[model samples]
Target: MTLTSTAPNVFEAGLPTFTYGLTATPHDILDDLRTAQSCAPIAIGPLGPEILSYSMARELLRDNRFRLPPGITLAAQGITSGPLFDKLTSSLLGLNGAPHIRLRKLVSKAFTPRATSRLQDTIREVMNGLIDHVVDAGRCDVVPDIARPYPTPIICALLGAPPEDWPLFVAWTEEIFKAFNFQPDVNFDESAIMRAWGELDDYVDGMVAERRHNLTDDLLSELIRAESDGDRLNLDELRMLAAGFLMAGTDTTRNQLAASVQVLCEHPDQWETLRDHPDLAMQAVEETMRHSPAASIVPRAATEDVEFGGYLFPEGTFILVNTFAANRDPAIYDDADRFDITREDAPAILTFGGGAHYCLGANLARRELAEALVVLTRRLSAPRLVGPAPWKSLLGMTGPTTLPIEFASERL
Candidate 1:
């Protein structure tokens, strides 16, 4: 893969400094880089070296010089020894080389798209039920009303856990992600992260033990089967993998769904197109992902000194591939700024990182988003933001934390 930069590498030439924190939304930070026009394909910042273009970001993700950012991330957070740090360093997102490949293969084998697809009936039911609550209200906050609660039931069912325990899983995963956030403030809660890890790990162990006696087609059972294949999958490995799935399978899809809804509501014409023709749900989902990805950045570190795109990345250099910027780069997409859902042959969505670390649940996430959109566009019309929809920090899985909208409920 060619690692050409759209501009001179920032590390050598006039280094454009990019800054990010709780003070600004991720989009605002990236927009500052765009507005200044001083930024290059790679911008150095507090978060990490920002990969601002498509080609460089994609290939570098697959390059051997780059690796998962657990070591660097742990150092940044001042968390060196604990269950939280260990989980950060040991999960699929943490490992590199042979172990990552082996574990990824086993997890991938169990976490199949077919398994998620089988739940189409359940997906529709969940989506419709969530919408049912707001159809009469004529206005609702999309995040808590839909996004936060939607994934829990689906993920719970997949794990063969009780659906009513969504709040517990949600709380645990929220703390779990704090360990990997690219930016954390002075108030970072180490205890919460450690506590969540411990509780979730123990709960997952119990669940796995209980499910082993009655193996079935659920994801937990499939993972158990993967372990039984004599790959020497141990208890911690199995438990952490399941916990990782709970985090990945929920938070990302939730944020993404909220982001997509926020984007659609903000763009009435696009929302109208989606509402008029529900068949465009998949296209709308793809466009939403590219335009306003839930995951603004994915982290990686330089495993060895490497010259990429005419820039030297010293070993242990932390980098954040800015999917938010790459998805909008003019060099890749025509009228890259436009929110048109009818885009013809727009590039493959880099919203999900490329290479091995590319999100395993991406396909399922897309389907879930599409199905939700179908239900939404069917039941609601002309969704417009009711008030200021506040967004979370861009340093991690970013999206509208609360998307209050007023839509004419056709079903109502």
Candidate 2:
């Protein structure tokens, strides 16, 4: 079942060209996944050539090794020379096994359910301010106004970033997603990224030094105090951990919020369902993750020869977990395409991923979304979309970039 060269004619005529074709694009991935899940759990790639899917992606993420393409990984190690688009394509998420697991675990403590729950009141207040800003503007771009600001404030605050520098943190974090090959013809945003990293690193370094000098209550302070078997984080590890958290929590949550709102806008009945029932917002967010996950394709490289779904994918093969497709698998979800908040049996969506790499930020993300939906529905008198919704071209994280909407005059 393995072929050396590219798979031919597997794509639909006139569809947009992408690594996963319709399966990867924001506009068409959901339907593509529903179709892919039924015909075969694994199929010849229309674009990725020899790539294969671990058909049971949702149930068995740990069954295979996930790594980035060697070429991409090597290229990523030298990110600064290039732009943002070029550097992030091969960033830390590309690592597999020990290194990936180690890095993820080093920072998991901050995103624990207990940790995020403590921030609920703060999250609500943050959402309140952002939504108020939107309402006051009368007509506003929800992406930058609400979606963009919400997550970074929480991340920056948790990381002990200064209030004035928080806006810069949000701007730089947002650019990382755009620097990869997903977009067309634009060079990477290297200067902004390097600048953001330097500012953040210096700030965090000072905070760490200060915390070391005199302990404090913040996460950065805690991380400095945390030790495993008398082993503390080295300076580089702390920087990586801080950088990773900012990257993981900020833009990712922003996209999820924007995508959730876009879905509600596209299906106003769903919006009404959420508005009427309010509780439906929880399930609605889950459905959006299933149907339009923030991360579309997860890249993995074979650590050794492996077999799955009757195909023997060779070692070193670049495999992609088409989570968007797996989430909509008919075998796993009934009527996967229909946005049913009350379906009651939605499978564990791949939005948080699974296995050792499962998102440590899961609870934090959910809590943020819960607060956001609650505040939006409760505060705005009648929140309505005001213009054509446009999506961001950032491949790794795609959502509405400009969602102009109007709320009642009194909502402000």
Candidate 3:
């Protein structure tokens, strides 16, 4: 990639910015930008320059010169050395090259398709249990009634933690994830976030002690035993690794599940298709993600000076690959904006990031989505949005903040 255009550098240029806030705007500025792209391929986003086109975004994500952001990105936002910062340094999110490969390889053992398939039963059990509470309610907020409560319990079960202890994990993950929202100007609470990570670490330490004495066939036990030949996870690695997994596993799935249902409820005929053919749950999840991904942007920083998509991004330049826009690029799909689960052989989605740093919990997240939709579509009928399904900023961990829907419960 070379800079052929004589236009000013993107960082300094007056590039078009999109609507990226909590307030509900009637029209998505991304759609306008998506349609009005005769000039440039990039947009000056809230977090540096954003790659908006599908092809360009894919190229950037798979490129090697682009690496995970440095600590200064967080440090810029007042997160200068805390439990959260330390966790980022040690966890897969902050690591690059050899350390990343090592930890990802060891942690991936518990996330393989076979492992996810084996855990699918637990997913169903948890989904069904949550449904038991809301199924008879007729009208309820999906975020609280279903989505929020669903993923953490499954994560606790995966870790062999007591199901009743899910609330603690949920609280910790929520606080810790706030650190990633990238609101450098906002009054970000550093102490609360750091304290949450410390609490989670303390909990993981207790679990490590208990599980070491009596290991079981759960993810914790698997992490305890996981190793790459001579290399093994030390207590510190295990504690941070498990805590990171719990955080990743919970917030992401919760947001995506809520987003999936909101999309389906908006398209009743699609919901009918999913209900009639429950097997379409897998495809439905794919369509929902592609249409409205809960995990939208994959943040990266330039490791070295590189010209990509005909623009020069100097070393340490922050970039956000806008999957939310890329997923709907007219160049990619025939009917890119339409939410059709029946679409045949849809291309792979970018919701899970890409290449070496692709989400480790992707398989489990998909299983959670598939099982959750299957249970919901089968047990509930005539699902329709009863109130505004308000959404948060797409800048990070995107999803509806609250989704209220009305439905009739089935006798199951």
TM-score of each: 0.90, 0.82, 0.90
Pairs of residues clashing in candidate 1? none
lDDT per residue as tens, model 1, 307-407: 78887676777788888888888889898878988888888978888888888888888888899998888898888887887788777778987888888
Deviation (Å) of 256 in candidate 2 = 1.3
Model 3 residue 335 lDDT score:
77
Off by over 4 Å in 2: 1-24, 29-33, 49-55, 70-94, 136-138, 174-181, 184-192, 276-281, 392-395, 409-412
Worst 10 residues of 1 by lDDT: 1-10
Highest-lDDT candidate: 1
After superposition, the stretches of candidate 3 with alpha carbons farther than 4 Å from their true spots are 1-27, 71-76, 184-189
Candidate 1 clash figure, as a count:
0
- lDDT leaderboard ranking: 1, 3, 2
Model 2, span 42-142: residue lDDT tens: 54454342222334675446664444553252243343334443334334554566766665565664444444556777788898888766676666777
Clashing pairs in 3: none
Q: Is candidate 1 or candidate 2 better by lDDT?
A: 1
